[model samples]
Target: MSKKLRNHDEVVFEQLLNPEMAKAYLDVALEEYEQDGDLGFFLEALRNVVEARSGMTSLAEKTGLNRQNLYRVLSPEGNPELRTISLILHHLGYRLSVQPIQS
Candidate 1:
């Protein structure tokens, strides 16, 4: 079922309903990609894990991220740009990487 649009703002409709632009409004997720690898590689790895557990089609539907784009960003060999990485991480409940501190 389509979700309700309570606000009268036209942009809200576009952001929530438009396939072409909805992916741009996503926020960052939790900071888990810094554990032990290159930032992009770690993100792609986690994206795969989440996608497998949740199913990519369902995840894409809920996240407003096109499956094709998600694939490109999360593929093992893919080098996702910052915005794309941010979007995927946000949708997957993950966040950006920060280097661990030395004791």
Candidate 2:
């Protein structure tokens, strides 16, 4: 029997398939954002988690956004509105939360 090798990205995507793993991945991104003050990390994490779940097309449908626009808004170069981001997170079985930073 022969074993096939999966790409790095493929493995990461698989990790996101598990809810706990996906949340952990996003938590790391959130921590990075807190330290770096970069919203792009959060956006990218959301995009990856969404893709791992139902994909952009289904997410677009749930969010009432155009498929192409969803892709654009989720891209690293794209900036999405808070409402849009909240909606995506809600649909993906997650929600935005506020926390105090540790000193």
Candidate 3:
């Protein structure tokens, strides 16, 4: 009998293929960010979305960002400015939204 193994990155990439799944992934990341104020999870989710959609090189071209720089900027340690983040999200077919926290 043969078995298949699913990798973490593969799962994430698959989730990114569905708009609802992708949004849920980002929503979890955003909840984490709201809890700890760490942007790594958020950025990582965005990077996964980009990779699933058009890849880093394509995103770099669309966003006018260098390929190497895009990798660096998408890293967990990255601290990209709002405009850069916005541009990347826009190119990836996503946008930021605000909502009131429930009491």
Candidate 4:
């Protein structure tokens, strides 16, 4: 019998299909981004969630964004605008909220 190994990305995407898991993943990613200022890291995490939810085409249709634009914006080098991020999160069944920083 041969055993097949699942790709790491595939495993991640499968796990992220759950809303709660995706939310927690994004939260951790956001915290890491804040700590390291690595925009790419955060963007990649968001992209993973997007892929898990469906794909660029479906998200583009939901948010009325161009599919190509979404690919570009979610790329490692992509710098997305605030409105775009908000729209993406909204469509992903999440929202951004401000909380007081604890000292």
Across 1-103, the per-residue lDDT of candidate 2 in tens digits comes to 9989899889999999999999899999888878898878877988999988899988888878899988888887878898888898899888989888677
RMSD of each: 12.0, 1.3, 1.3, 1.2
lDDT of 3 by residue, 1-103 (tens): 8889999889879879998888888889989999999999888888888899899989888878999988988889999999998898788677877899999
Which stretches of candidate 2 lie above 4 Å from their native place?
none
Best by TM-score: 4
Candidate whose lDDT is highest: 4
Candidate order by lDDT, decreasing, is 4, 2, 3, 1
Which regions of candidate 4 fall more than 4 Å away from where they truly are? none
Pairs in steric clash, model 3: none
Q: What is the per-residue lDDT of model 4 for residues 11-54, given as tens digits with 9 covering 90 to 100?
A: 99999999999999998988998998988878889999999988
Candidate 4 residue pairs in clash (backbone atoms < 3 Å): none
Counting only residues 3 or more apart in sequence or on different chains, how many pairs clash (N, Cα, C under 3 Å) in candidate 3? Answer: 0
Q: What is the Å distance of residue 8 in model 3 from its true position?
A: 2.5
Candidate 3 regions with alpha-carbon error over 4 angstroms? none
lDDT of each: 0.55, 0.88, 0.87, 0.92
> What TM-score, computed on C-alpha atoms, does each candidate reach?
0.47, 0.90, 0.90, 0.92
lDDT of 1 by residue, 1-103 (tens): 9987665444444343443333233212123343544455554544544443465787788778788877766766667678776665566555665656757
